[model samples]
Target: MAEAIFWVSFAFVFYTFAGYPLLLMVWRRLARKPVKRGFWQPSVSIVIAAHNEAMHIETKIRNCLELDYPCHKLEIILSLDGSTDGTEEIARQFESAMVRVIPSLVHEGKAAALNRGVAAANNKVVVFCDARQRIHPHALRQLITNFSDSTVGAVSGELILVETESSDDDTSAPMGLYWRYEKWMRGMESDIHSTAGATGALYAIRRELFRPLPEDTILDDVLVPMRIVMERKRVIFDPRALAYDKVACCAEIEFRRKVRTLSGNYQLLVQAPELLLPWRNPIFVQFVSHKLARLLTPYFLGALFVSNCFLLRGFYLIPFALQFAWYALALAGWLAPERQQGQLASRTAMVGKSREFS
Candidate 1:
């Protein structure tokens, strides 16, 4: 019984951290192909849902205005959801004939706010971006370029964590480290098949493919792209198009964000059961590696510890020793929280941060 449990635990970790990445590399190599270019420019509506984002609204609007796409071909839609502050007023200042502001009397969550923006959008493609994030000058052009392929239903841009100009030595330590690893993983996933989820910070989809999400939906980003996948269209990730955003001010704030995300992940599993079944999805490799492995991480970790505890007898000591080493590392992370800024420390911090945010 102990041996069985040990093997099972080992397999879970091995598959998640090692096996999955190797599979992605092989798949990506086999799937590599050159992209065809054309003059398939489609009208795009860029939507931003602002909830008390007064400080960033002006800059975000300016960024949208500066996009490389044709002015007549692009429409900017900013939605202020229940802003008691100057969020609406700030947004209004940026509103020109090209930029429109949709104000909600009461604050609805992000999903509802985005839905309102979608209704007001007058374009063939709708691009969703966070009010707090800044897009590269060519982001919209790069994203829209993918639509040249009719099979591409959605396109997600790379999320780049911008380091604050003022850093007290460890300033880029947290956000920089986290995003680097995330970018690496995303690149691997993009090479293999469709990415599991789109970065909510910057993603675009065909306006015809827009679906209204539940009002309380926590992960609008995941749901939007998953909906496109459900329609049998590929959701491609374009690294060339990037969105930059600041990291949370503190670990606690970051934790709350992660908790909400993790809860949404759970909700996704309940909402999309077919994604869990390998036989039903041809891109089973993506579903299992990107989503399932993440959802099962906590449970897998616990099972490993418990199984190791029971394997104290002969030869079981090896796995038990390894388990202890992992725990020691976790403990060290807790003790010297500042160490969490480095690459290894940041990855550990991210796991803890996710749990706290959830």
Candidate 2:
């Protein structure tokens, strides 16, 4: 039973990170449904959700105004959620007929703000963007171009992490590697069926398919697109539609952000219980294999370590020794000098990225 528990936990962790992606690659190669890309123009609404982003609101508006899409077809909505800072004022300063400012009287979080902005959208194609990132001029055109395909319901753009010379090497290095790996996985998922979720920084979806997310919902990016997938419509990841954001210089901030996102995964499962039922959800296999399995990984890892301790005798001895050595090296890497530590993290991240994309 001890060995059984150890093996089960190990298998869970391995399957979640490594096995599922390998399976996706094989399946995608066997059956690929590529999006039909063309030069198509559709009425699009650009929704910006800002909370106390007074500094970037005006600049974000300017960036939106300069997008390569037709000015007549493009509408920009700046959704401000109880921002005490001059975010609303800055957005209103645009005073352009193309830009509309929606200010929520209270701090209702991002989901509510998005719901309000999306509700007021005049166009069928709703493109969600954040205040911090500057999207490429042609990104809007590239993203909406996917919708020219009748089967496509949503599309996500690639977000490039812009790192400056003065950026923190420790966090930015690993993050850059991870982001590349993430983009590759998303592209693969899109090719196979639909992306697991859309990127919040830059993603477009059909207005008619837009279900109002719960007020308390986090990870709107994942929830919205996954819901689209539930409707048996494709959600694609378009690398050509690129946007840029500064990498988080501090690990703590990134960690907190990830924690919130992970928690939202759990929230999503609760809010959309039907997604777990294979009969109800078209992408149930991918949803569980990719999303839910990852959420349970930490517990699987803990179980593997604990069970290994109990089964250290006989045949388990070799495996136990290997695990001990691995942990020891990991600890040593963390304790090494800053430069060496950063290098270790970068190497590990790149190795994972290479394996995923290879």
Candidate 3:
């Protein structure tokens, strides 16, 4: 019984993260259809919300200006959300006739900033980009191509982890691995239906479908695109359109980001319970495998530990031993100073910290 339970839990985790994604990929490949680019060019409003982002705001503006889109048709809107540093000042320096700057006195979160930016938008399409992320020259074009299909209400670009030129040690292995898996899963999900979520780093939606997110919202990227999905409009992933950003060099920094994201995801689940309901959403399998599984991972880990402890007195030595071995591996991963191990440790620490903080 103990062995069966162990396998069942293991299978659950595996299927949720890996098996389902693979199945989706296969399904997509079998029923794939080509999308043709139409001669339609819509005015695009590029909205960027910046808060204490002086380090990369200039680069972001330069990249946006250099994008391969019609100069007159593309408008850049930068919202400086109560930035104390030189963020607002630097952004204002780039304020030409094409770029508009919205300065706020209060430091609202990204969601509020984006809401304000979207309201100021006068284009048919709104593309949200992070101040830190650098987009490919043709990313906007690739995203606009998907708009050729009326069913596609939102389109997210592929995020590539830009290899830091300073590091020859391949210190970004864990992040690289995660991005590869994410890209694969997204491609598969796009093939069958809409992707489970979108990255705030680079995603575009029709201006008409824009909805103001709650002020306390953390994952505006996911919430915005999921809103489009709820409206029965397809949210697509375009791998050809790429945005690149350096993976966080500090594991602690990355862990904090992930914890905040997870907390926001929990909040989203509460706000949009219908999205998780199988009967309400026909593509329940994607939601369960992609989003729900991530939310339940900590609980699953706790359950596994408790079950192992409970079965220690029974005739389950082998299963208990296996559990110990698996935990030993995880511990080893935590102890090692290598990037991969550090990242694993950061995730584990986040689970513990989130529980404590909650």
Tens-digit per-residue lDDT, 25-123, candidate 3: 777888664454566789999999998887889999999999999999999999888887688889889898789999898998888999999999999
Off by over 4 Å in 2: 313-318, 332-358
**What's the best-to-worst order under TM-score?**
2, 1, 3
Query: How does each model score on TM-score?
Result: 0.87, 0.90, 0.86
lDDT of 1: 0.80
| Residue pairs whose backbone atoms clash in candidate 3 | none
Cα RMSD of all models vs. native, in order, equals 4.9, 6.8, 5.0
- On residues 1-358, what C-alpha lDDT tens digit does candidate 2 reach at each position? 8789999998998888788889888989999998888778889999998998877887888899999988999999988999887788777888677999998989999999999999989998999999989999999989988998989999999998898764677678888888887787888889988888888899999999999989999989998998998898999999999999888645545665789889999999899888889997877878888788878888988888889999978988887898889889878756768646555555666687456434
Q: Candidate 3 — which residues are off by over 4 angstroms?
A: 1-4, 29-36, 165-171, 302-323, 337-358
What tens digits encode model 1's per-residue C-alpha lDDT throughout 1-358?
Answer: 8668768877888888778877777867888543444467888899999887767889999989999999988899998788766888888887887999999989888889999999999999999999888899988889888889888888899887665543323445765676676667767765555677899989999999998888888888888887787777777889999898765544544556778888998888777777777766656677777777877877877887888798798888887888799899878766775644444544665787456434
Q: What is the lDDT of candidate 2?
A: 0.86
lDDT of 1 at 230: 72
In model 1, residue pairs whose N, Cα or C atoms come closer than 3 Å (at least 3 residues apart or on different chains), thus clashing, are 255-356, 255-357, 256-357, 258-358, 259-357, 259-358
Worst 10 residues of 3 by lDDT: 163-172
